[model samples]
Target: MTQTENSQFRIECDSMGEKQIPSNVYYGIQTLRAIENFQISGLKPLETYVDACIYIKKATAIVNGELDCITPETSKAIVEAADEILAGQLRDQFVVDVYQAGAGTSHHMNVNEVLANRALEILGDEKGNYKRVNPNDHVNYGQSTNDVIPTAIRIGGLLALSRTLHPALDNAIAVLETKADEFQNIIKSGRTHLQDAVPVRLGESFRAWAQILSEHQNRIYVASGDLMVLGLGGSAAGTGMNTHPKYRDRVVEVISELINCPLQPAPHLMAAMQSMAPFVNVSGSLRNLAQDLVKISHDLRLMDSGPKTGLKEIQLPPVQPGSSIMPGKYNPVMAEMTSMVCFQVMGYDSAIALAAQAGQLELNVMMPLIAYNLIHSIEILGNTVAALTDKCIQGITANQERCLEYAEGSLALVTALNNHIGYLNAAAVAKESLATGKSLRQIVLEKELMTEAQLAEVLNLEQMSAIRPLGS
Candidate 1:
């Protein structure tokens, strides 16, 4: 053949090649090549993406079956194929790169191609044949990239919460609880402005951490519930223009059943398509969780401050050598990593907010960016929480000697003795004890303020460590 004819034949053959893609899809090598060429975000397709593909396949089959677009046999074949993909059997067939800018068109096509191929296999037909089942016409019958992308995002978000975030949060809570119980009797000096303020049991501090994490668990649940309310039937522009009325609710039911997660339709399709309020809310909660992690990591670092001169109230597990020059120096590397994760989540939150703000009237073209940011936030937070709980929190051991030493030297203990003796007299006794290098008990004894028994009764350890005043 001549060069021109040979080139034309090769192009036609490649266009109809028996590749991973199904035949009915308009998306071809050009679309896949464009996505692969413009690699952007470092994140690959996450579990949420996989979950969304499964959800779309199941929901589409149910919708098409209900609308008489496909017979029960066809629906069953499509769902079986989708289940195979969902079970991770056909992952290699999904060949689109992770970074495309056209509102996840590449991802949608990837899912379409994979499902179509699997459905054709179930129907005993070769891949890339539109005879038995077409990718767009049969698989993606009544959906658009707009509705599918967002719905998939919601499904992915919910799955992340259930499978990753909740478990990690639970682990952290368990570690905190265990620490609280272990350190209930260890008294330490509490600091407010980075200066000694009062006496507090080490357990009380851990309990506070547990409480913050529990609150975040609740926040995540609320945010995830918002995600559960999906925009399933809002095809193209929230009008359900080409989709049957029954298709909307039936698809939702199928999705809800397939994922075993409650899925609801939005009351207003236009509002659901145009407003990214759920994303904003979920991202805000993630930011709040990140802020809590920052505070917790900071406190852990401070508590594990110095092996030589700092607070040194608690010791963190040394994962590796901390310093290059100092041979014996160990650092709180897990705590530091936790802090870094917090900053990353904070950045993701900012990205989500910016994407939300950029949404327009009919539909948000920024759904892909929103999904990318939120998934990153969820995965990072999940892994960080797990690391903090397993590596840092569980291994933390209170520095009993240092805690006792600091508590003994702290003047805040005088507050307990002040109630029995007058404040001026207590101050005078404290000043004398410091100057004369004597204990407060010794100063009080020398001044004949009260008998040793009376002093002991009034300045008991229990009184000094109480979280609140005796009654009020």
Candidate 2:
């Protein structure tokens, strides 16, 4: 070919390559590409980002309907498109990196493009025909990225709680309840300062675990309620600029119906846009739950420490080869994983807290990091709770013999005997039994302190299992 023909071919190829792509994601693509080019932060978009996108689409459709900016047919099409996206139909079409630091402008645009493309499909038109129904002008007619992005983040966080975290916590509570009922009759030595201190039933310890988890469940719900109030109608700077008068309330109503939850408009849009304190509060609550989980996991590990040399009151399910060099050894791998997840949640909480502090006068610029860390915390905690419940808690069985052995060895039970006899006499009986490696029954028999029938009535396991009255 001649030079002119070759140049024309090159130009044709370039135009084809560019034309095949959509322009709505210019900001999203640029942010993703620049971040990839720079390689600054190792963060990525979270699953919560998808939920946020869905919220933006839904809210936009509602606002557009109220403003009458688009035809009724176009508005219906937009709503349907948003529904599809929320149901996860457009996940793959979103290819932008999640690590951008522009307050989720890229994420907002991604949702807009998906809805526009989907709306175009509904109209039998091509994707880039903004003349028919533009993603920004028609779909996102009454909102700004600032308000839309934060609203999406809040909704996404709620979605994670409803779908993943809440169910796992429910399962954990069920496991603890089951264990509590199972261990009701098993007496154990309650320890203080790593030394035996008092007599207690094993069921009581499990009950404590159940109560702690139940309380956290309530806390998570409260934090989720705070998130339900959204900033959708606030527009660019909370003044409702460029938005129709009825836009804010109408959008919130549509979103509430779509999400199947009551979502109120934020009372202070400027504060909502400028401060990430809500995310911080939610993350802090999640971290508090994580800390509790860590303590419970640690206690479970300790309770099931060893089959031979340690307090083997319970047995955990073996998931993998526990050691490389130590043959026939199994480890508490589930507990270790749970501990690590808790620590990660703590670290994510710290990141979210710092990001909240970074917010300034009119808008918080660090929303990328805030969104990243908060969603990461939710995901990790959700997975960890599920794993702990399924792999560790469900299959655990009480080591009855070990529990009995420890209970029998504990001198704290002497307190019960002291009520019937003198305290000094009970201590003497305990000391003699330990010194002679004799059972309590045998020592009591040798001492002849009471008739055999009397001893049987006083030392009965049923009576011993009864929770002693407060002061007694």
Candidate 3:
């Protein structure tokens, strides 16, 4: 199949049949079929995901060229074409719907076609000229969708984390730590079951959140360790069929240097190809992070609840108006948005879990779903954490007076009186204080449960709400 001069479309043929592809586009017949077959989601592949695929193509071209599997001229053209895509050219050529065919063969062919056609152009040949630079023979010389898609997902996940999520987590942890130090002296009442329970340092809350995020960061890193092991070179059902004997190790080495990330070939290629556990592990870690983020966001909203009616121990930066009808209300919009994104990540994780187990014998037909969901979770969670850090966490201010008032008025302070006055007497004093609308100190003094000096020593607000170090 070939394109004629002055034609709007090119005739491209495959084993199944032929289709007319737009002359201007690099993607060929298989990609066109995919575009027509699946219209679900309308979402395209993530840029990092595309880059991951292109990286594999570039590495494979270099390796195949050195191994004499493809001619030097053909390999050079393919490398140049892949470099162009990596430099952010021809992005629109990867137009396959994200929901398309099982095992991501449609998308894999789309990548191969784009690179093959672009290479043909570089070699002074017209598009659709498979004899000049074939998509299957030269571009995807030693790969199958089975091997390539999973490898792409691993690379894509690592790229997304390094470029977006990990840095976001670091910045968020730093911001929260700074806030913890800044608010270390402020005291506020702690609540259990939505009832006042004890006193706590305002800064300690931020410190706890920082620790939570820091721990989550570590867990995600641990889970991502599995991504570095490659099942690539396990072409066509993991038998290394038609692959060069040296291709597996050499390609992994090339990819590591190409992407600037350390990588290795799996000892048992079949197991690596068969198991979707790596993706499931990473997605589960992300879900774990999302759950903690929801808790932190809820805490922020509760602390910044109201100026006149609710607990006003902290104030979040009023980024936008809270209501359409209300004139002078500002909402914790940043934290609210963070919660929503985190919720979405949690949902994506669940989908990834289900898709991971749906894989049968040698390859997961559901790789495309896992790829999109896992990478999407990492990127969105990263972006949301960055926004939350910059807009809300950094701008938060503690209300010193309000914090002091809550710490002072909470009836839970009576718990500190137990050692001196006994539990029964302390309970009696708290009951009297509530019944007569008296202060805890006044009720205790009237009942003569302890001396003023003793009460003062036991009920020191500073001591009661001392800020503890993180992990203490």
Candidate 4:
């Protein structure tokens, strides 16, 4: 990026005029215009998105070669250039901002320029030799910014979910499952409306969290199924104009083979062009997951709120110091991180919903922003979940004695007497326990409601927190 501009730079021309591009980079004038035009986030698109673009480029070359639209030699050079990109070389060449032109036209052109220049170099031609391997004419044959971008976003999003996000989720789920088993014997006072209610095993909470992740993981896979249908051969407007009749299937075949995922042409090209429902569906699942995580993180933070006075039922591992002035203080930084990530992901979900609705006429121009938000959210959640699992959830320990003390003193334990003693008698015992600041057992025995043996049999602590509550 610090390379000095010089007269030796290659001159590239487009519809606008000619400009000198850096000699060392593969990008061209269009990419340069895009870089200077939208500097909005300073951050570039994710590498998965870049790889998706490469998939499209490689597939297009293969299909073009088979169709005899371009010489096999030209296809070979283009594919080789794209291969380098897929393999993580020339990543800096994709310089366009994620917030660029809504249709991602700038990015699509960036890909074309990079591949064209590299192909030109492979053909023993100088840079900017458009006559040899023009970026648009030869490299981007039978494609448009519209179809190409939407398809790439799907490809990239699904790739991120399977390749990165899901693995992180699995790790978190495994940690939860292990913790659930470890804490199965630890009974705690369950809170309803923030008031102590009845006995419940701490293990159940962990199991529920694991189940939430497992369910939502399935939902993501189901939503991503819609991504398999692509609108590739639907040139400019999805009318399939100027593309060969078999080009759609052939391109999909080549892409599927390259990515090792089964893919098919969109059932309806025009509808696919204008509709972003697939991305929305995927984001919906993400939104659900984020919402659930927010709740889980908050609950963990509350449980870990104080070693002195708060719920004190659990202790989140202290990954960092809580305050600058306070000694012997540590905070639930991991839980706080997951909570923040969940909020940001929910915000992204809202934006994706709005963008999906913003589509109009033949194409949705909101794709660039959607792509940025969706893919970024996916990656952030993946990393955040992994951190929480490693630094917080896995290291968390239950305050077993504290939990038992709360359960022993709770006035709510009087509910267990309702079956043996009359309802009125049980209610009186509960009121007496609350009024005298005495334990439920003390009040029940003092009231002569039942003998100690009957009380022990009827008020079985283990039975109260069992999978099936007694008499229910």
Per-residue lDDT of model 1, residues 1-472, tens digit only? 0123333211212343422323434344434554556577555567667667677778788679877988787788888887776777766555555567556777786677667667777888755555577667777888888888888888888877777888999989988999999999998888888876567899989989999999999988887888888787888898997888788888888888878997888898777778888988998999999998999999999999988878999999888899999899999999999989999889888888888888777878887778878877888899889988888899999998788778877766676677778899888887877788788888888888879998788666656776774778
Candidate 2 residue-wise lDDT, 1-472, digit = tens: 0123333211101211322233333222333344445455544466566776676676667667757767777888888887776676656665555566467776566667667667877988755555676767777777788888788778878878877898998988988899889888887777878776565678878888999999998998888788888887788988888887887788888778777888898888787787787898899889999999999989889988986888988888888988999888889899999999999899989988887887667788778777777777887798899998899888888887778777767766666667667788888988887788787677777888666787788766557767767999
Worst 10 residues of 2 by lDDT: 7-16
Estimate, for each residue in 97-191, the C-alpha lDDT of model 3 and write its tens digit: 88989999999999999999999999999999889799999999989999999999999999999999999999999999999999998888988
TM-scores, in order shown?
A: 0.88, 0.84, 0.98, 0.96
Model 4 over residues 78-171: C-alpha lDDT tens digits?
A: 9999988887888888889888887999999999999998998899987677786888888899999999999998889878887778999999
Stretches of model 3 off by over 4 angstroms after superposition: 4-6, 467-472
lDDT of 4: 0.88
Best by lDDT: 3
**Candidate 4 Cα errors over 4 Å, as ranges:** 1-7, 469-472
Shift in Å, residue 184, candidate 1: 1.0
Q: Give the C-alpha lDDT of model 1.
A: 0.78
- How many clashes (backbone N, Cα, C below 3 Å) per candidate? 0, 1, 0, 0
Q: Please give the RMSD to the true structure for each candidate, in Å.
A: 4.0, 4.9, 1.4, 2.5
RMSD in Å for candidate 2, one decimal? 4.9
Candidate 3: residue 371 lDDT (0-100): 89
lDDT of 4 at 414: 78
Off by over 4 Å in 2: 1-43, 414-465, 468-472
